[model samples]
Target: MNPPLFDLTYCPIVPALEVIGGKWKPLVVYHIYLGAQRFGSLLRCIPTISKTMLTQQLRELERDGLLHREVFAEVPSRVEYTLTQTGLSLLPVLKAIGAWGRQLKEQQAVPELVA
Candidate 1:
């Protein structure tokens, strides 16, 4: 019998998914690409996500180098999140996928007319 193809060390995609392949991760990435945003802004943009889930997802993205977190020390601390170079590199791919989805939706909307 052949051994399994994916040992823990063999594939990075498996681990990458752990960081950014959830229902909310892609949305977060897409929004952050538009501009740097604070946590409150992210919560507003992704209204369906619970605060706990959003915080967990952001921390995961930051740990994976897909996002950068900046903290400003002041009377009350300020923080912002922005995409890292690696994350920004994914923008074109996301845009292309979104365009394709829109085209597919348009195609599905018109009923076929019999001649």
Candidate 2:
């Protein structure tokens, strides 16, 4: 019997994609990689994302072992997010993707208006 064209279980990229897929995932990771981040700063950095979505993504990332969330003992409680070793390893790949996209955008962009 012939195998199915695309098997979901055996594909190597599946796990990686699961951890890093979606519009906000990479952006969230990239921002955290810049330095450890808090909820408020991530919200500011990614202005278009809603709080609900951010919370969901962060939870998934933490579940996937790509993020470490720390809570401090304080009056209001402070939480911070940072990359785990696995997440740090993925940074180069993400950076490459970002560079490729920027190059494509530059090629398609209009000339800048100099002051």
Q: Provide the TM-score for each candidate, comma-separated.
A: 0.78, 0.84
Evaluated against the true structure, the overall lDDT of model 1 is: 0.88
Candidate 1, poorest ten consecutive residues by summed lDDT: 1-10
**Residue pairs in candidate 2 whose N, alpha carbon or C atoms collide under 3 angstroms:** none
Q: Specify the highest-lDDT model's number.
A: 2
Q: What C-alpha lDDT do the candidate models reach, one value each?
A: 0.88, 0.94
Q: Model 2 TM-score?
A: 0.84
Tens digit per residue, CA lDDT, model 1, 34-103: 8998999999999999999999999988988999999999768999999999898877867877899899
The residue pairs that clash in candidate 1, if any, are none
Q: Per-residue lDDT for 7 in model 1?
A: 75
Q: After superposition, how far is residue 87 of candidate 2 from its true place, in Å?
A: 0.9
> TM-score of predicted model 1?
0.78
